[model samples]
Target: MNISIHSFTLKLRDPFRISYESRNEQEALVIQLSDTNQQGQTVTGLGESTANNYYQVSIERMQKEVALVRERIEEYSLANEVLNAGQVGTPGHLWQQLQPELQHSSFTLCAIDVAAHDLYGKKVGQPLYKLWGLNPADAPTTNYTLGIDSIEVMIRKMQAKPWPIYKIKLGTPEDLAIVRELRKHTNAVFRVDANCAWGVDETIENAQELKKLGVEFIEQPLKADNWDGMKEVYQHSALPLIADESCIVEDDVAKCAGHFHGINIKLTKCGGITPARRMIREAQRHNMKVMIGCMTESTIGISAIAHLSPLLNYVDMDGALLLAEDIATGVTITTDGVHFPDENGTGVQLLTPSPTSLV
Candidate 1:
């Protein structure tokens, strides 16, 4: 059994803007696990979104868990048992069986699942989606995001493009005025992502106000833990609510089942594709709609999500659309929506890191 880890920097195609802030580049960590079996060999690769302390946590955990997963893979190999890739319930149990010192690391638990899936995908020669029973042809239409900018600037940005649907970032009451002005420009089916910036009363009032302006949904209007407020807003507001920060982990879905009408599942927040798929299924079981989303990731991460977006109820994978230039290949997003990779596996092409100045 062997494990290796490497860190890479993913430069954004442009200065990615959101309700929180903007960034120019993203750093990523890739972990690979391998077992020595000349006749029946297995290898797995997992990537984590890099930026600030987020990757730091996953990277440190990956460093610690790589050896443990390697040992587990070796033991499984020796037992000659079929290593199921889509076995979600097994890993949770296996993690608990580990030593008490290694019991509570979320990153380790997440990395184990990712590695298992990657290895399974390689062995079966099928993409992750195929293993999960998703079709590439049925990819969902994604909404292009408009960052927190002046109404005029946002309008100009929209005018310069031809995206049918757009999502506006709204964090303050001032955004209400922006939405009002935006309504005068185009009648596109628009959504709002408040990013947990509003309170219960404010979200309720804003949703009511925006309802008349043809806004489609209000995402994460209140804080993640504000379940009572979210339920109150959901009951009284005409606008549909989508959860973002509130539903970070799969288990969190049950907590928000009645509070939000929909959830925005980002691969990073859910740890990776394995947990993300589980989250989608859990959301469906609870009758909550799904929105496939992304962090400020490059095409590698977005491409991974694009493969699964077609099966989701809503898609907000415009993270690459906001960039000025992309790493090229894997997935392509047109004004209409996103397109999945035609190749087997994740369909993400990792390009040779180039020397380019950050915008």
Candidate 2:
């Protein structure tokens, strides 16, 4: 068993501004796991996790977390020669084994869990989506994000991309005004995300007005801990509400059941595909709409999100599309839709060789 780590500073085409924060550069940790499988094939799998100030996750912290378990990880993999051989030792089982060291940093846990799944898929010679029996044709169209900017600049972005759906970030006083103005230019479907910036009354009011402008849904209007407030808005708001920060892990799914109409699971937030699959199933059991989103990451993370699209009602995997340049090659998302590469394991190949170390 071998592990290699590399970090990159991903430059965005424009400064990505959500309600809580804005960033021009995103720091990402991409790791590769190599091991000879039971069939004696050397396979390497890729995984990614980005630094997020909102979540208080830093590259230094993730690196330390990985270092803490480095020896155990290698030893465990070596001892269990057929570690990921079959369902007996799945990604979920691996996640449990590493939980003690990585539990403090979901970002770190996500990277390893995703890499393990990618490795398993490659060992079996199948993509994760295909292995799960999902059809690419059933996947939903992903929406391109438009950060907060002047209405004129926003309109220009809309004109430039001309996508089928646009996720318009809102939190300013001129929120509806921006949407109304952008609506005049194109008939593209609009989805508004306040990023936990609106109040209960404000959310209800905006929902009614935004619904009239063809806005499909509202995402994380109030603060994540404001369940009392969300209850009132959920019942009164004209548009459906999707929870982002409110739903972090599998346990949060049931907690968000009555307050939110759906959930937007970020792979990094929920600790990758293994637990994310459980989160999706739990959300479905509660009869809630399920969505998967991405941060301003490279194709390594975005490609992992793409394979989960077939299980979602909505998708926000346009993270890589907003990049000025990408560091890896994987599933490609274009204006038309997502295109998977002709290879397996999220179809990711780093454009450059891994660095000696990211510390």
Candidate 3:
């Protein structure tokens, strides 16, 4: 098997603003796994992950980690002749073996894990959702995001797309004012994400104001490690709390059971579909709602998250929707929701090679 990595900077359609920062671009790494058979039939699988500075995974760090992971995979394939590209191992086995080395770099591991799943899905001639027996109707409607900006600017952004569901970024003094202002323009459902910027008392006050504005939920209002603060808000706030930075992996879900009403699972945060599926099940087992979210990625990464939409409660896999330019094709996003194409694997195809390379 041949493994290669490509790096690219995805330009955002608009400046994406969270409480922590704002950006017009994001860094991403694409991983491809390929092998040619005796008949000269070459099969290639692709996966991508965006590197987020907020998550502590920088572009340089992710690139270095990918190289290390690729070298390790090559060594394992050489040492174990039984593990071929076709019959490498179950997702569980593959992950268990690499967990120790890849544990700290979930974002990097996500790219490899997604690529492997793409390869296996293609070999089996089925999409991952179909393979997992998920129904298309069960997939939830996705929410388009509105970042922090002046009242006029933010309102203009909202009016441009006018998606049914909108995720509004908060944490500024105008957090409630933003919602109140948008409410005057449209009757769209709203979800607010504070990006872990408020204190417990402030979150309670904000939640009360948001609930009155008919905001659906509040996401990560307090800091990630502020368990006590989150619990305090969850105990009294009118809106349900959804964990983003607070819930990074499956284990985090267990710890966040009573503190948060729902958990936001991102492929970049949890590693890949394999672990993400596990996290969903775990969250469900704890009687918590599940949301599948994403970084500002391209079709390659966002499409990977879309495959698991059937298992999600609230879908925010609109990372690709925010891109000014996309290099892959597959899923289609509309005001209604996301629709997948009839293709094997993750239903994504790279239209062109990334022009950038790892320096």
Candidate 4:
């Protein structure tokens, strides 16, 4: 068993603006795992923030982690064991044991899961969705995002696209005006993402105002750590609230269960697919809706989530739509919704490595 990593920069097709910031490119770590038996797999892991935010693991640091994990794989013969195990424990229990090794190494854990799924899917000659018992024919329609911009620019952008669903970014009082203007241009179902910009009181006020704009929901309005405040806002506001940052980890779901009407599950934030599935199940049991989302990643990551979108209430897997030039190939995005590959594995095709710069 062996593991290796390469750092790549993905240039966005257009500058992506959010409530927090904007970016022209994204830095990502591509981890490749292989065994002596000729089986090889790859997973692209994105850092927390975009290129300008400095939230990424330094290239040097990432390389070192890859080396360490590669050594561990060899020492434990993990590749052989993972491949040969007739029936592994439930994804949750196996993930629990791997969590210690994964602590402080989110990128590695993400890579490991991707690799494991790729290997497993290949071994069984099935696509990832089938392995998880998900049927692509049941996927829900996905929403495309309209990043923070002047009202005029937003209106123009909306007028040019035929997408039936759109998510607007809002973080300031000025955003109220933008939302109003957007409502006039398109009757598409709308969602607002505050990105934790508002406090409990402000969220309540803004959500009230947004309700008149025909919003379908408001996402992450209050701070992630302020569960009580989120509850206050959720209870007071007429519009539904979806938890984003607040539901990054499994336990975070429990904290926001009673407060949020739904959750935005991102593979990157939750570590990987294993925990993400658990979060979705838990949210379902609590009667909370699910919105599977993604960071600013290539089709590789978005395609991974597209396989599970059918099982959720909402879908926001539009990160690939924002990329300037993606590695290209995987999921297909139409104005109606995202379409997955009919082939085995994730249906993702790894392109020749092309590295860009964050600076």
Over 4 Å off, model 1: 1-4, 32-46, 52-119, 353-359
Ten-residue segment with the worst summed lDDT in candidate 2? Answer: 78-87
Query: Residue 70 of model 3: what lDDT?
Result: 71
TM-score per prediction, in order, is 0.80, 0.95, 0.94, 0.87
lDDT of 2: 0.87
Ranking by lDDT: 2, 3, 4, 1
Ranking of predictions according to TM-score:
2, 3, 4, 1
Tens-digit lDDT string for candidate 2 (221-248): 9999999999999889999999998999
Q: Return the TM-score for candidate 1, rounded to 2 decimals.
A: 0.80
Tell me the spans in candidate 3 whose CA falls farther than 4 Å from its real position.
36-40, 75-88
TM-score winner? 2
lDDT per residue for candidate 4 within 156-220, as digits (tens), equals 77787668899988886688889888888778899999998888888888878888888999999
lDDT of 3 by residue, 9-64 (tens): 88999998888899999888988876543345666678888888777887778788
lDDT of candidate 3 at residue 320, scale 0 to 100: 83
Tell me the lDDT of model 1 at 22: 65
RMSD in order of candidates: 4.7, 2.1, 3.0, 3.8
lDDT of 3 at 37: 32
lDDT of 1 at 353: 45
TM-score of 3: 0.94
Q: Judging by TM-score, tell me the better candidate of 2 and 3.
A: 2
